[model samples]
Target: MDIKTAAALHRLRLASIPEALSFPALLIFGTGFRIAFDYDALVMPLGMLHGVLFVIYVVLLLDVWNRTKWPVKRVAFFFLLAILPFGGLYGDKVLKREEAAGVAAAQAREEGTVDA
Candidate 1:
């Protein structure tokens, strides 16, 4: 892939991490606030925050999928991870691994150690 495309994918991957992690944290905090303190008002704002983050996460995921040409199963797995609690953290780890591998491959190509 070209440098521009690789850079875009890397940005998308980085952008996804916080949204993925925040959504779950908000969900937990929202639920806890509602149940423990009867602060139902907290849910509305938290839900909205989560909803926006979820949308961003999905958009980034789709962008990454298109750029990376990931398999359907892999894309679906990442989508599923978005909805599960703490799944974003796991997704971040996976993305980091993929990023490292992609960088290594790109370096190899640049060094003429591997043919495209």
Candidate 2:
């Protein structure tokens, strides 16, 4: 995919993962509070939002994989990361580095200064 599309997708990917992951984390924490201190109220909205963001993240991942022509392993890792709490953070950093490298290479090509 072009760098602009890639950059946009990457940003969406970053946004979705954390929001999705936070929902579950918050639920767990809230549940703990309810059980430990009898402070139950409602957390369904956060859960629903997280679920929605997770779905969007999946769709975005597919689009990114298609556009970037990523290998099956790489795509799998991307999906797997979303499921784990901290995986998204790691994936975000890696994706940013990859995207930066891609932009640099593209610039090099445009300038006709890239090494063969």
Candidate 3:
């Protein structure tokens, strides 16, 4: 990938991590707080927050997928991960690994030691 596309994908990937994490966390907290405290006031605000984060996550996911041209399986994996509690941690790890690999490959090309 070109530098611009790669950079954009990286940015999207990074952005997705926090949104993915926050969505589920807010949902869990909202539910727990409602049940434990019998207070529903927090639900609407929390739900709105989660909804916005989820939309951001989906948009970023699509942007990254388009830029990276990842396999459908991988794209689906990320889509599914966004809905699961704590799945963002896993997604972050995967993104980091991919970024490292891309950097290493770029360095290797620069050094005339390309691997196949």
TM-score of 2: 0.77
Question: Order of all candidates by TM-score, from best down to worst?
Answer: 1, 3, 2
* TM-score pick, better of 1 and 3: 1
Question: In terms of TM-score, which candidate is strongest?
Answer: 1
Look at candidate 2 and tell me the lDDT of residue 95. Answer: 79
Tens-place lDDT per residue, model 1, 1-116, is 64445665576667667777676678788999899998899888888888888888888888877787889999999889878867777777877777777788888889999898
lDDT of 2 by residue, 8-37 (tens): 556755775575467558768777777888
lDDT of 3 by residue, 53-94 (tens): 778878888887887899999989988887786786788788
Clashes of 1: 0
Selected candidate, larger lDDT, 2 vs 3: 3
Off by over 4 Å in 1: 1-9
lDDT of 2 at 60: 80
By summed lDDT, which 10 consecutive residues of candidate 1 come out lowest?
Answer: 1-10
Scored against the true structure, residue 111 in model 3 reaches a CA lDDT of 78
Q: Candidate 1, after superposition: displacement of residue 102 in Å?
A: 0.6
Ranking by lDDT: 1, 3, 2
Model 2, C-alpha of 107: deviation from truth (Å): 1.8
- Estimate the lDDT of model 2: 0.73
Error of 1 at 107 (Å): 2.1
How well does candidate 3 score on lDDT at residue 18? 72
